[model samples]
Target: MKRLADHLQPGARVFVPGLCGEPTLLLRELAQDPERARGVRFVGVQFPGIGSADYLGLHPEAQQTAFFMSPSVRQGLRERRAELLSLDYPGIARHLQQCPPFDLAIGHFSPPDAEGWCSAGVCSDFLPIAWARAKRRVAQLNSSMPRTGSAFRVHLSELDAAIEADIPLTTFSEAAGGSETELRIGRLAAELVRDGDTLQFGIGSVPLALAGSLTSHRRLGLHTGMVSQAARALDEAGALDPDAPITTGVALGNASLYEWAGRHPNIRFADVRSTHDPTGLAALPRFVAINSAVEVDLFGQVNAERNDGALQAGSGGLPVFAQGALRSPGGRLLICMAATAKRGTLSRIVPSLGAQGLCTLPRHMADVFVTEHGVAQVRELGLDDRAEALIAIAAPEHRAGLEEAWRAIRNRL
Candidate 1:
């Protein structure tokens, strides 16, 4: 196991942390002199909101190959900062299990209990595959990581090196709900949603805002990657409509979502396979896949990956739904985000994605891009034209700069 330093080299394939399961301390070693680290590619499925700062964003020297698109990695890919490997959840696990062993893998775990077992902590979905195949396994021990029942814990003897840290583990929370901007995005996304449409709900307050307004709707269904309190509120309000089908692969909350699901019949949990089956999603009529983007550009590219070194918000079922939405005769795939973040100082709609923004949603597949200000249909526009329309939707304060930059360009016209 001490061969950890021997097997890795420039451009070596490394499976790094994932899905709120990153090793922040190991990342410090990774950030070592780029000259020595130049050829390493960190690969895994994690989201920006869940990963460490490096995965949220990566050092230029480390190339990346990911299964699910997260914010930080999306930023890098979009900006051509790094290479990306975009695949759905099934595709990710399939690759890990069937593909060649990786040079190294970074893992997280809780301390071994008296039973000589350690839980995969909060993320067990991909750990088993990574633990077995990766040539070298580095464990980052976090006492705070939840010891969930389904996780597969490894013993300390099995770990090659255990780096103990007192850092906070990641968890997703309801966005501070009921903002005027969120309400606006919610209403528009809701309008596109028709009666009896199967839905994919995402994190953030927009879902809550939209959930409240759906009380009058009927036969609506949910089969998503994650669910929040809104799902319960809708069920209790009789808006969930028991006669209809509802399913999910995962549920999350600050304890409220759990309490609501304990005895609920509507909430059925499934593994990644059934949850994100492209075929199953294709069968649903009038499917509406509503997801949020960090910031969308004129071309409708979506980057839902890394913010730090670790990934928090993996694509989960989003790509599968996006493809399925395209197949549905009347289906709609919407990427919704606030026009500005960071207290309105940043414009979510920019002429181009950031230097590190990766394209999670390829421009062609993107149907609608929505901000608090308004929605823009960029489905089939030229690059310049898409830029023009996107700028119009930018926060009122940032539009001028985008336009000036657009105008300065030398076009063939």
Candidate 2:
């Protein structure tokens, strides 16, 4: 611990790995001796739901800068101890490249192989970029981390310091038995996907349900930002293409999925520059991106980042993937969400996205909108027709109110 603390100087900007790549042993050590990290600025891309650590809480003088907002750092934001970059995955990579170099970078990696090469394990998104930009590098070599293949590899000798720890890796397991509405929306979204389509989705009950609905499809390829436990089911059902490997930036699932990915030849982790790049995705045939949102308006605006005027999450890689899927020759962008919130009291299909809600994707980017009621294909439709299609899929109880609101909004236009 003394040797590791020697690298931490006051006012130094340090990069810490987030998600499944977080070094629990190292972070715990730092928290134990708060004086060591006093006045230090910690930066990383910690996600919501999966990331539980509050880096700003490590010390009274500690500051945190992040690209995403989560409950872990919301207090810091309010206290002015945290700053958000407000960028997507690709934007984050670019910022790390052009910004001032970090004083130190601490990352978790799998044990070196016979060739002395260490895999980035479950997270390869921003660690590689931060590693290159930091003046000094440290590696936490975890024996439990699955040694997945990726272009981002680190030699044990490259790191200035190496700490050996065999702690349990962080895991996020979706709850069993999704809600009835989620299953219905999943079935409708699955109907839009062909047998051989390449898929991109994130972590949620809807995606988990969608994976169950897709077991009968053949030769489905995955080029996604995060690979969940659903990938295993698809593989077991012979739904995924046997020849094509699963390309993702991170593997976030339960311990069983981690054990399955260990030294697995079919999984290839990639950096955000490749995983979230629109041009690369545009070339894939029949690309289908299934995403979710908090709400949508008749104007085709999608708000995935906020709920009731509060920042609940970040606008992750959705916009980038939406662009890619829209440009693909046979691609489809499916936004799946329940027709209403609060047990059908509040309509998610609103007449307009008011100032309280932050629009993650604007009106032009919308394509297929799915709900438990039905599917709304509005990519080629006009403003009036698009509103009609979306209203038809909204919850039946709210249909009358939505139509009345839309008429008033239409007159203004």
- Clashes per candidate (backbone, < 3 Å): 43, 0
RMSD of each: 7.8, 1.2
Candidate lDDT scores, in order, read 0.67, 0.88
Location of the lowest summed lDDT over 10 successive residues in candidate 1: 1-10
lDDT of 2 by residue, 1-413 (tens): 43565678889999988888887876777768778878888988888877566778878778989877786578888888889888877788899899999999998998899999998887898889989989999888889888877889899889899888888888887877699999998888988889999999988789989999999999999999988877777888899998997889988887788877665678889889889988999999888999999999998999998899888888889999999999998999999999999977999999999988988999999999999999999999999999999999999999899899999999999
Candidate 2, after superposition: displacement of residue 360 in Å?
A: 0.7
How many backbone overlaps does candidate 1 show?
A: 43
- Quote the lDDT for 333 in model 2: 95
Residue-wise C-alpha lDDT for candidate 1, range 74-139, written one tens digit per residue: 677776756555566877777788888987776776666887666664455566676789887767
- Predicted structure 2: lDDT: 0.88
Candidate achieving the largest TM-score? 2
Q: Mark the regions of model 2 whose C-alpha exceeds 4 Å error after superposition.
A: 1-6
